[model samples]
Target: MLYFVYTADRPGSSALREELVEAHWAYMDGFEFHARGPTLSDDGETATGSLHIVDLPSDGAARAFVTEEPNWRAGVYAAMQIFRFEDLVGRTMWEFPGPEGERFLVTGAAGEPVGDGVIVHGRLRGLDDGAVHGFAACVQAPDADAAARTVRDGRDLTVRPWCFGGRR
Candidate 1:
């Protein structure tokens, strides 16, 4: 299954994150990752989070991937999201083929992460509006619980799961 993992830096953790970028990339390269990248805003220089797509056998494997990741091992993330996506567009953020990145439409209930689903839409890879209280990316996971666990480890999180077109 394809799992989309979204990682958000903890408060005041950007410096630590910058320090681990190279190592993070190098580590991801060693795995069976489709494409792991940072989430850039409209300006495209400010990295808000990270998006990673990986093929795994089960949620346990996905959990292992997160636990063994360089950045996560180095404490670079404050939260993350794993989605059981279907590749509605069947494309990657790098394959969107536009000078401008994607624009996503993430829909969900309030206080539970409304933009998590938007990351799946290629055009809106990391784009968000005011309602998008937070940011997230999408992927296809073995199941909904596994997708949710990709971000939560018995901790509080504002994650939401929705159908394909639901991703704005």
Candidate 2:
């Protein structure tokens, strides 16, 4: 099963995050990730959160992945949201064909399921039977408004600046 892991950094935790970067990458190397990145501030430099879509065996495995991450273990995250996910675009962020411009993470209650112009697209799954209940996407757009419009056919959405993840 695929899991969506969204982790928000605690205020003043950048130093801690930097300190654990190597251990974090080493831990992540053990998993199969579909899409992974750091959520950025409006200026596009500071990392405010971490986003990852990973394939794991069960909800328990997903929880373990998040809780065991170096950042989480080191108290770099103020909050973490985990959900079962379905890959609608069926591709990784590395497979994105569009030009690398500004990117945003657009997510909300599932509406009409738009996949056009998305680098990564997926739906949040229900806890009981794995039915899709919400939608999410990482998209390249000129601005947050445009990114939201791309996926917001009629649902409430939250748009956050984002970028592709990994070493510099």
Number of the predicted model whose TM-score against the real structure is largest? 2
Any idea what lDDT model 1 has? 0.50
Model 1: CA > 4 A from native = 32-35, 40-45, 100-168
TM-score of 1: 0.56
Clash totals for all candidate models = 11, 0
lDDT of each: 0.50, 0.85
lDDT, candidate 1, 1-168, per-residue tens: 666577776767678878887777766765555445565444544566676666678766777878788778888787876654334455554453434323322323221222232234322122122122333334333444544544422233333332221011
Worst 10 residues of 1 by lDDT: 122-131
Report how far residue 102 has shifted in candidate 1, in Å: 6.6
Model 2 agreement with the true structure over 34-153: per-residue lDDT tens digits: 889899898887899999998899898999999989899899999988889888788888888887799899889855435456888888986568877788789888898888878646
Alpha-carbon deviation at 57 in model 1, angstroms: 2.3
TM-score of 2: 0.93
- Which regions of candidate 2 are displaced past 4 Å? 112-116, 128-131
- Give the distance in Å from residue 123's predicted Cα in candidate 1 to where it truly belongs: 15
Query: Who wins the lDDT comparison?
Result: 2
Candidate 2 weakest ten by summed lDDT: 109-118
